[model samples]
Target chain A: MTAFDPARFTRLDQYGHGGRLGIRYHAKAEDWVELALPYAADQVGDPSTGVLASGPIVTLMDMATSMAVWTRRGVFAPHATLDLRVDYCRPATPGETVIGRGECYRLARAVAFVRGIAYHRDPADPIAHVAGTFMLMDAPAKQARA
Target chain B: MTPPPYAALLGIAIEAEGDGPPVLLLPFGEPVLGRPGFVHGGAIAGLLEMAAIAALDQALQAEGGGRIKPITVTVDYMRGGRERPTRGVGTVTRLGTRIANVEAVAWQDDRARPIAAARLNYLIERP
Candidate 1:
């Protein structure tokens, strides 16, 4: 397996679901990755309150955890989400960019355990917390070039 | 409850279901794609959450209107969402003055074979 390249990773698939949600690379380390979801009117859950929807935040964490998996493994491989659980502690401050940071706590041969928090202004007072796992699909056979 | 931003992003539409809470229909599109051909898990989660909210809203309207605040949600992905219309309906397991528990399932083709299921807990603020 080759080392994970942040530059290439961000550029390769820039128009997937995560990208469409306005999720962008924020920062990353050896075993963790952070992504940001900018507040948008169309993403608001409640217009009166101008609060962002849970889906965007969940997507942010999903992408963050996925990137973290690649970061920890030092490579990118196809994986599927098994399950995800989220706890909304506080409503994310409206009009603020939500930052999602995910860490790969345990990486088994077939599964990876991840936990993350979403926040806008204060990390301590996060908007939501998430815990999930991804199933690593076995390496696939070589694909034919189009 | 109104459709959230994510719903619009995914083009999820509300279809009337026999005068009850509307059913959520997620049209297959680029924004909902995952992997190569399947619907993204996040998109499905978004639909489930919306369905839950819609159901809760209807329930609240019945027992006196109230504000809904999401507290927690657990989503289980059972199968990949194919390139077809996906529908989801939420059921309120218990509606109380303070807390409400809801469950939702999204499926395509056969309603029995759900692509995903979600359980949500919301904090209600009675008017």
Candidate 2:
């Protein structure tokens, strides 16, 4: 097992769904990771309002939480999402990049508790909030690489 | 009604039948993949939300027309989605003047066995 590296992670794969959506690593710490999703025409839920869909924001948070689990463990291990709850506070401003910050608050043997928020320049005024859990694989060999 | 651009990005289409809610179809491809062989959780969630909105839109249209705005959603994953086309549909349980509650489910191959389910709340702006 090795420490999770966001820079290397992006350079390795460029064809996954996340990559196609332009989700990139913004910042990270010991127990949390922040990812960025740039607003694009393809992500618009409403052509009238030009607001990004709730789905893309969900994707951003999922990836951020997945990476946060690895960062908490200090290794890139395999895991699966068990459940997730997302609350949309408001519509994201069109053309503004949405930043999602995921934090692994608790890590047990088989599960990791995670929470996150999506915002623009200020996290205090978040556009969305999420809480979820990931089920850890028993052995590293059983990892799914998500 | 035509789906938005985000629906196309997820490879989703509305399958309307006789007097029933529309079913959303998500085909397996590079745009929906996670890891290598499995579908991404977020993609599945996206599909569910789309289905929910479609169902709620139908309900609201009957009463006159209104704007649908998402409030919250909770998704529960039961199984890993394989490399296959997934189907999702939403059922609006309650439609009030200001709020609506919808339930959505995503399944592959068999409807009885769902890969994931979601509960969503929306705020409606009446016209």
Best by DockQ: 2
Could you give candidate 1's per-residue lDDT for residues A4-49 as a string of tens digits? 8554565424676776777788877666788888888888888779
lDDT, each prediction: 0.84, 0.88
* Model 2 steric clash pairs: none
- Pairs that clash in candidate 1: A42-B5
**Each prediction's DockQ against the real complex:** 0.73, 0.84
Whole-structure CA lDDT of model 1: 0.84
- Residue-wise lDDT of candidate 1 within B63-121, one digit each (tens)? 98988889998999888899889999999999988999999999999999999999999
Tell me the spans in candidate 2 whose CA falls farther than 4 Å from its real position: A11-13, A139-146
Interface RMSD of the candidates, in order: 1.2, 0.9
